[model samples]
Each structure stands twice: as C-alpha cells, then as structure tokens.
Target: MTAPTAPPPRSDAAVGTPPPTARPSLLRRVWTSYAFRRICQSVFVVWLVATITFLLMHLMPGDPIEIMAGRLNSSGMSHDQAMATAANIISYDPNANVWVQYLEFMRGLVTFDLGNSLTNPSKTVFEHVMEYLPWTLFAVGAGVVLAVVIGLSVGMAMAYRRGSWFDHVMTSIGSFLTGVPNYILIAAVIVVGYTMLGVLPFLDMRGRITAGVEPGFNFVFFGDAVFHAILPIIAFAFTATGSFMLNMKAATTEVLTEDYVTVAQARGLKAGRISRSYVGRNAMLPIIPQIALQLGTLVGGSIVIEQILQYPGAGQMLMAAISNRDYPVVQAAVIILATSVVIASLIVDLFLVRVDPRIKSEGQDA
Candidate 1:
C-alpha cells in the first residue's frame, strides 16, 4: 500500500501536468465577445448619422422647395402651385410616410444612384462626382503622404536630439505655423506664387484635363495636369505639415520615454536601429488613426481650398450644389463625404487592431 503512495507524489508532477490552455474556436469566441457589441454600436452610429444628414438639409436657411419653385417659375407661381410643385420634386406626397423617405435615401445610397444635379446642366450628379473625385484623391493623397513623411522624419530627429538647436528651430517653426489658419496660408501661397515666384498655376475649376481634348494617359495631358496640381498640393501640404510635425514630435517624445524603449537601448542596439525600428513604429500608431480622420476632414473642407485655387474637386462641386440648392447634388456629395469618413474610420480601426493588439481586443470589447 505504501508503494502506491502516488509514486512519492512525483517530483516532476507539475511539469507533466501543464496548465490548461484556452483554444476556443475563433468564430465561437467572436460571437460571445465585445466584437458583437461593437458591430451593434456601429449600426446605431450609422442610424444616427443618417438622421443627422437628413436634418442638415432641413436646417439650411433657404428652402430647397422654395428655391425650386423660383427656378421652375420665374414669373412667380401661386402659393398653391408652388406648394404642389415643391411636393412633387421633393417626393413629399400626402400618403408618403417618413419611413418611406428614409428607405428611399438608404436605397439610393446603396445603389450609388444619386440622381440628377439641379445645378449642373451638363451632367448627372453621379457623372459630376466621377469627374471630380480623382483630382481630390491625387492632390490630397499626395499632400498627406508628403506631410507625414517629412513631419515624421523631422519629429523623430528632434525627439532623439531634444534641446538641440535643430529641435528648437523645428519646434518653433511647427508651433508658429500651427497658429496660422489654412485659408490665410493658402491665400499667402497664391499671392507669393503670383507675385514673388512669378508662377501662377493654371487653376481651372473644371475637368481634370482641358475640355475638347480626348482623354488619355499621355505625357502631354498628364504633365499639364500634374503641373496644374502642384501649387494646390503645396498649399495643402504646407498647411497640414505643421500639425503633423507637432503631433508626431509629441508622440515620438512620449514613446521615447516608454520602458520598452529603455529596454531596447539596454540591449546594446545601435541608435539608428533603435530609433527607426522601435521608436518610429511605436510613435506611428497614434498617427495612423489621426491621418485617417484628417483625410476625412480634408475632404470635407477641400471646397475652401479648391475654390481659392479654382480646382475642380468634389468639394467645389459640393459648394456649387449647395449654392444653387441642388437637392440631388447636395445629397450625393454629403453622402459621399459622410460615407468616406465612416469607411476611413472603419479601416483605421482595423489598422489600429493590427498595429496594437490592445486596440483590437479593447475595441472589440467596447
């Protein structure tokens, strides 16, 4: 019986009996986790977003209905006629329910069918969007990339050599420029270009290429298009760079203080290697989400810059639509811009998950 004494209680017992591991099926875990809550939250957000968008048009000063009546009848129709006509154009039939309008708006969005533009006689709202979106992407996208690269590089250098003359100069410059409004900077850039530089960009707030010319990816048109885009790009990039520099510099400084970074240094890693690989990667996590939000903001505000530069981006089109009370065009542009922001944010969330596993797990939980 003593021989059985559990084999002397086995000195290697714990080693043989390892702790149980969690290996829940991926789908099963996700179903019961906070990820499900996040999806529900996103759906709720979309509902609120739709309601807000619908209300935005309603809140504008001049009634689109009245404006349409004025446009349709310059001689001034009777109140009854105007009312009837507005109802017709707006699809405000007496029998129609609020839910019907909401459903219609949602359907139009899903189908990418934005209907006609009341402002632009030459093309449908959809066609107008197609014409302008590319330039916006090219100009804004290039400017963003340039700003991020330049800002990140300078910020990293400044952070690594804090209190140096170069750092002082950059910090001062970034802080100074941060105070200047984008519109003022854009105006100044244009003024400088036209006056000091003696180079005015051929800014035509129309199609990407010259009209009456067949479109092709040839050097002639391509070069001219790029040349036209350069000044606006510079203006946007210059305006955006200060914020990027300041933010990245702050993040880098904060990340440099992290314990892991200290451990990295303790490992005898080269300064360049440690800075580029460790510091830079960690510093960039915060910047990624920021860049996503900035893109959406830039797209929304692009009209101001576009109008000043006379660039035919979607923002300019949106502005024109708003000015004319072009309901279809207005709705289309707003939806496009809103949807872009939502999609960009979603993509950023996914990216954040990848960059920092904590965000993924936490976001799922939230």
Candidate 2:
C-alpha cells in the first residue's frame, strides 16, 4: 500500500498529456455551414460575371476615349478640344496601366461607388441607376407574383381534374403560352392593339407616369404609373404563368400518387382537408423554389420588354447605356441584375426551411 501511494497522483502536465481541445466557436460553425457555403457560391458567381463584363467591355473594338472624343468632335468641338474634354469625361485613364484601372473599378464596385456617366457627366451612375431601378422591380415583381398565385391554383385544379376537358384545354394553353416568347407577345400587342385596332391607348401608356400626374404617395400618381406599366407586366405574366402551371401540375400529380395520400383518403379525411394538409403543401415545395428562380430571371429579362413599352425602368436605362457606350452604366446594370437573381435564390433557401416540415424536423433532430 505504501509503495503504491509512493507514486504521487500524477498531474496531466507531469504525465506529458495534451490539453483538452476547445469547441468550435459559433461564428466558425456558421461559416462552415452548408447554407453559408451556398451564399458564398452565389456571391462568387456574381463577382465572376462582373469581372467578365469588365474585360469584355475593355476588349471591345473601339477605344472608349477615342469614341468619346469623336462624339464631342461631331458635336462641333475641335480635335484638340474634344480630346481634352473626352479625357476629362471618361473614367478610363490612358496614362495609367490596365491593371490599375481594373483595380480601381473593383474598388469602386466593393465600395458601392459606381463612377459618373461617360455620356452625361453631371450625375453619378448610382444615382441614375437608382432613379430607374424601382420601376422595373415594381412591374416585374408584380407580374411574377400574379403569375405564381394564379398558376398554383390552376395547376392544382388540373391535377385534381386530370383527363377532363378543362384539363386538356388548360394543358394546351399552357404549352402554347410557354412556347411563345415574351418579347414577341409584346410586339404582337403593339402591332395588333396599337397599329391595327387602335384600342390600347398606346401613346398614353408610353412613360412611367403621365406628365400632369405629380409623383407622390397619392392614388393618381401611383395609378398612372401602374397604367403605363400594364403592358410590360402582362407580357411577363403570360410568359411566366405557363411554365409555372405546367411545373405545378406535374408536382401535384406526382404527390397525389404517393402512399400517404392513399392513407389519408382511406382514413375518411375530407377532400378539402387532405388536399390542403397534404397534397397542396407537398406540391408547393417544388414550386416555391421555381417561383424564386423565375422571379429573378424575369427581372433580368425585362430589358427588351421595357424598351418596347417605353417604361422608363432599369431596362430603358441599360438600353440607353449600351447605345451610348456608357461603360460604367452598363457595368452597374449588369451587377444589379445579376445580384437580384442570386439574392432571390438565397432568400428562397431560407424560406424553404420554414415552409418544408421535413427540413425543419431534420434540423431539430440534428
């Protein structure tokens, strides 16, 4: 006993044992999470798009400086005078190296500082973009929401009434609408409604808001804005609704065939209760992600539609920028459009966890 006690209780340090490891911090855990990884991927894609756009514009045929100078010369300035003015107006510096200009551009992008307009030097590109972006967001956003809501209802009906005349009619309409391009729809409206029928009041709806209608929180101003945006909205809705309806119909039909649906039916659950509690909710799981994706793509694709409608939105500004070779403006528009799509996707992921009970249950178990 005395011999055993002679060996004193050895401390961890005395025994040359390693220290216990500390747990990972919350911030570190979050950074390594799947959701965070997805967000980072989206951000990286946006940055890559921006970099490609910058390089492509820079590598284009004409020198921005020379182009600007020539425009000024055409406007009655002498060669020397135009060159000097052009040097001042354009942000690209000929004297500096290409890498230097790229660095500056990237810095500006990171800081939310888009440079001044090359064509119109008075206002910064950010101001111009902000002025027009809201209209596009409102018009496109409304159209997407309208399409999703209507599509979900109609699609569910088609699933329930599978093989009926109504289903056949809707299925054909969906296919036809899906096949037609949105821009073509807009063109057809202009050609038939305005050119031939003279029924659209097309000229009256040419701008974002009517001239005499003062812009305010008042009904008249808002109403006028919506009036002008009607055609663009309608075009987007028709183009998007078909795809949503088809997708929803497919999802619902599949869900209806699952075993749980049969069990619910055998349990004597009311048709309405079973559809809402099980089928519709499950069907919506797939459609929700699509709605998010479609909303984002619609926003980016509104350029031609807005241009045709004279809607005075981001698309109109982008069109003007490209036509005028406004480099900074074009870059800004690209970033904004790309960001909208990526951010929408990220937001939808967050929503999915809330809408989907299985995801929530798994998360709790983990």
Candidate 3:
C-alpha cells in the first residue's frame, strides 16, 4: 500500500499548521483600532455637548435677536434698521420653527461656520474664539507646567521623608490647597492683598495687559501679558499642584515597595541616582495620565477664573457671550471647552500606549 504514501509527505508549509483565521472586515478593523475609537468617541462627545448647549441656550429666557436689536437701537440706528440688522447679525428668525433653527445650527456646525456673534457682529464666532482662546491656553498651559514641576519635586521630597514632620506639614498644606476651590483662593488673595494690605494694584491687574503695551514678541508686551495672566495662572496651578503632590507621594510610596526598586537599591546605587532613575521614574508613570485630565479640567474651569481675574481669555469671552445671550458664541465656547477635554484625553490615551509597550501589546490582543 506504499504506506499510504505518508499523506503526500505533508508539505512543510502545511505541516502542523492551523486553519487560517478569517481576516476582520475593514469596518471591524477600524472599530477595533484604539486610536480610531478614541477619535470617534471624542467627536461624538463634542457633538453631544454642542447639541445640549444649543438646546439650553434656546430654552433660556432671552431672545438673542431682541437683545441684539435693543443694543443696535441704543446705537441710534432706526428701530426698523436695528431689528433688520440684529436679525442679520444673529441669523435667526423669531418666526422660524425650532426644528428649522436646529437644522440651521447643525449645518453651520458641519460647515465649521459658527455664525456672527450678537455682541460683535463684525467678527464671526470663530474670530472671537481665536482672539481670546490663546490667552487662556497660555495661562492654563504655563500653570500646568509649573504645577507639575512643583508637585513632582515636593511630592518626591515628601515620599523620601514619609512619616516625618516635613511630610506631615506638606501633606497638610496639600490637602488644604486641594480642598479649596481655585476661585476661592483667588478671592482670598484679592481680599488680602488688594482689600486689606492695599499693596496689589487691583485696577491695573484686571485686564489682559497694560493698556499701552504694544502687542509683539518683545519683552514689554510679553512681561505685561504674563503680569495680567499671573493671577489666573496661580488660580489654575494651586489646586492642581496640591492634587499632584498628594498623588505623587502616594505613587512614590507604593513604588518604594516594588522589587525592582529594591534591586536597584541593593546594587549600591547612589540615593539620588536610584530615586531618579528607578523609583521616581516608575512613580511618575501614573501621574502622566492625570496631567492630561488636569489640563482638560483647567480649560473647562477657566471661565470662572478668567471672569474673576478680568483676563480676556476664552473663559471671559464665554461669560460675556452668555450674558449677552449670544447663542452662536456661547455654543462655540461650550463646544470648544468640551472638545478640548475630549481631545486631550484622546491624546494622552494614545501617548500612554507609546510610553508603555505592554499597553499596546495587550490592546492588540484584545
């Protein structure tokens, strides 16, 4: 029987080979991709937030058209001209059905054409946002950087001296700071310095920069910008710094118990060297995700801070828009804030995958 021909000598390619797995469809593959999902999720969240804000703004008591028309009349425009101009600026018809208005808003959203503001008809909502959002971002960004540096340093120090007086004192300070809202802290400072101490120039500190400081890449403008932004920056940093310090301390303490850290210590590594390379490094991994969250939160929370500081950031613009019942601008600001958080979270999620390869490998397996 020729020994059954040994099954045709089983081709090496086929030998011990399992059946080929069916490839996932393009749709399935896209759905499963981490980055794709995150991006889609962010987009959906932004859309939802925009929709909700739109609905709420419409539901609010004031009619933006009337509000704008009244302002135009105050500008000495004829009543007929004022109403017509207001309608044109706001692009709203009081007679239109709510659904039609919604459709129009959605169309604008898709086209990236947020309509002209009721308050500032000369500029589109986007122009207003571009003008102010940068200052908010600068303040928030600087504050987060400063907070991270201070928190990490103080946190690491606290970790090293855990259970000691230094650690206890720092922990108390951190807890207090975190517990207090940034706005309250800012108010307290104003009360103490401007009201009580009569030191800080409250009036001069209220705007974006000194009135005469020319806008440029030069020192005078830059210094003035920093000066105006300082309070908002401190407000942003205070709570975040405290939270970071506490979190980092906890992370460090836990990392101290890890086997590898112990191994590094046993190797006769210098205290500073081991802490920096091993314990501190590993301890910081957890804090990386928190930084992204902190930024997102700060941007969203900037409204209150900016309003209080009279800092001409997106937050201040948003507050003004809301007060003026400027629907388009309000919608823009809400979407911007919510979208920032979503985008930031998505970015950090992707970044974490690169920082730790195991996360990527596991995601693939999933």
Candidate 4:
C-alpha cells in the first residue's frame, strides 16, 4: 500500500530515463572470456614444455658437470681443478631430488633468471639467447615473407588457370618441393649454387656475416649480413613455399566454387576485381591462419637448416648447447622455442576470432 502511494511521486528521470546500464567488471569479463581460456591454455603449454624439457635434460645420459669438467681439462685446467670448476659452475647440487631441481628451475623462470651457462658460467642463458635470436629472426623472417609472396602469386595463378599447363607445371614443382626435406633442400642449394654453378661467391657458405665485418648500424655491415643470409633465406623459402602454395591453391580452388564468387562472375565484374575482392580475398582466409601457425614452426624447423649452413642463429646455439650438454642453455632455448610456438598459436587464435565471426561463435559456444 505504501509503495502504491509513493508511485504517484516517482521522478520523471527515474521513470522515463532507463536505469543506468550495468557494465560487467573487467575481471568478471575476463574470467568468463574465451580469450582468457586460450591464454591459460598457452600458459599451460609453456609450463608443460618447461617441465618436460627439465625432466628430459636431467634424465639424459652424461652429467652436464662431467661434460663441463672434460672441456675444462681440455682447456688446460688440471683434472682435479676441472672437477672443482665444474662443481662451481653448476652451483647447485645435481644430486638433489629431481623435484627440488624442478622447483628451483620454476622459481628461476618466475624471476626471469635462466641461470648461467654450465660451460661458461660467466655468461647467462639470456645473454646467449639474445646473441643468437636476432640472426635466426632475420633469416627466418626473410624466408617466411618471401615464401608467402611467392606462394600467394603462384597459388592464385594456378587457381585462376586451373587445368592449364602453367598450373600443372607449378603444381608438380610444388609437390616435389613439398616432399623434399629442408636439409636436403639446403644441401641441394649449396651444391647447385656453390659447387655446380659457382656463380654466387657472395653467398657466405658459413656464419651470418663476414668474419671481420664489425657489427654496427652501417650500410656495409647490414649488406654483409644480408649477403650471408641469402642462401639460408633461399633454402628456407624454397622448403616452405611449396606448402603455402599447395594450401593457397586448395583454398582458392574451393573459394572459386562458392555461390558468391559465381554470382560476382554473373554480374560481369572485372576479372581482376573479382579475383582481388571476391575470390582472392575469401581464399586467403584459410591461409592467414596457416601463416600465423607456421611462424611457430619456423623456429624449430630452422634447426637443421641452421646447423647445415653454420648460421649463428638460435637453432645453431641450441645445437651447440645440446652437444656440450649445457643444461641452462638447453633449458632456456627449449623454453624460448616452446613459448614462441604457444604465443604464435594464441595470436592466430585471437586473430581468427576477430577476423572470422564463426570462430568467435564457436568459442562462445564452447
């Protein structure tokens, strides 16, 4: 009764103006979000990788300390002094329970302390990573970019020309290239360019740059770096382009058959315009995700290629670390690689969600 009486005196602002819209809190929004789940999944992936890497390193044959001691002995230290140095270098009790070591490793990760190199206790894991990561990024990045460009052009041409001789010829080549391993491709390139043709004297068969070229921001230095990187880039691009071409061709072929493309054709749209705005655009959707996902593999995939080329990249560093049984370096490299893959996958997932509404819908549904 009291409320009914008060209703007559209700303010116009309260009655006419709708109640203020209640916005969700940021924390609440994130807690309930698909993106948040994906992020958590990525974090879990990193943790799993770190854990596995740590366990494997510990389980592998030969002690890192022993390996270090042997190297120290070879470097002129007395056997006993080498043993002591090895112990000092490790700084932690290798005989400690595996769980304790894992906890320490996790703690170091939390603090961004990847520990010092077992072989060279003076240099930290981060230092080594920073030293090697850039070269890999440069060579691998150049390769990926070139591969994408070549693939898209070739793939689109094939799709448009379908059963033409050009299409058949390219498809066959792509198939052949895709079947060949990256190392095999690298060896073939080296053989063909340096051995058979002998025309590429500028192609540095080893190292990222000329040995005496001082590292700087100068054109000469950068040009030298580029010169050294050419063969590796070509090798990586040749190995990768085939997959991209095949994927793009398949995607383009499928897209061309869609009703919207058919309707666009019936409307007498220009071939170029239709191809660019309709067929090409739609076809690229699948390829975009592939490109994003492929970024992760580029790091790991470069290992053999880098090893063969003697490129001073992360892959080469990783190989060196493994050979030396450098625990900290190996752990750090694995972590970096795993993190990269997880991050790439996360980026692609988020990108797909934004660009393709269907992905968002599916995420919401899940």
- Per-candidate TM-scores read 0.79, 0.88, 0.89, 0.89
lDDT of predicted model 4 = 0.85
lDDT of 4 by residue, 1-366 (tens): 355544467776866977668999999989878889889998898999999999999888888778878888999999999989888867856788988888989999989999888777888999988899888878877988999999998999998899999999999999987888878877876788788999757345578778789999999999989988887788778867998888889999999889999998899999999989998877888888777566766778889888788788999899889988888899999898778767877887788777777877787777
Model with the higher lDDT, candidate 2 or 4: 2
> Candidate 3: global Cα-lDDT?
0.87
Better of 1 and 3 by TM-score: 3
lDDT of 3 by residue, 172-270 (tens): 999998999999999999999999999988788888888777899999999998888888989999999999999999999999999998898888989
Q: Give per-residue CA lDDT, model 1, range 287-313, as digits (tens).
A: 888887777767776888888777888
Candidates' lDDT values, in order? 0.74, 0.86, 0.87, 0.85
Candidates arranged by TM-score, highest first? 4, 3, 2, 1
lDDT by residue for model 2 (1-366), tens? 355546579889888998888999999989866577768899898899899988876776666678888888999999999988888877566556878878989999999998898877899999989899989888888899889888888999999999999899999988987898888988898899999999989999898888778889998888888899899889889878998889889999999999999999999999999999999999999888887778776887888888778788998898888776788998999898888878888888778976875765565457
RMSD of 2: 5.1
| Prediction 2 TM-score vs. true | 0.88
Better of 1 and 2 by TM-score: 2
The Cα RMSD in angstroms, rounded to one decimal, for candidate 3 relative to the true structure is 3.2
Candidate 1: residue pairs that collide: none
Query: Which of candidates 1 and 3 is the stronger one according to lDDT?
Result: 3
Model 2 CA deviation exceeding 4 Å by range:
1-24, 357-366
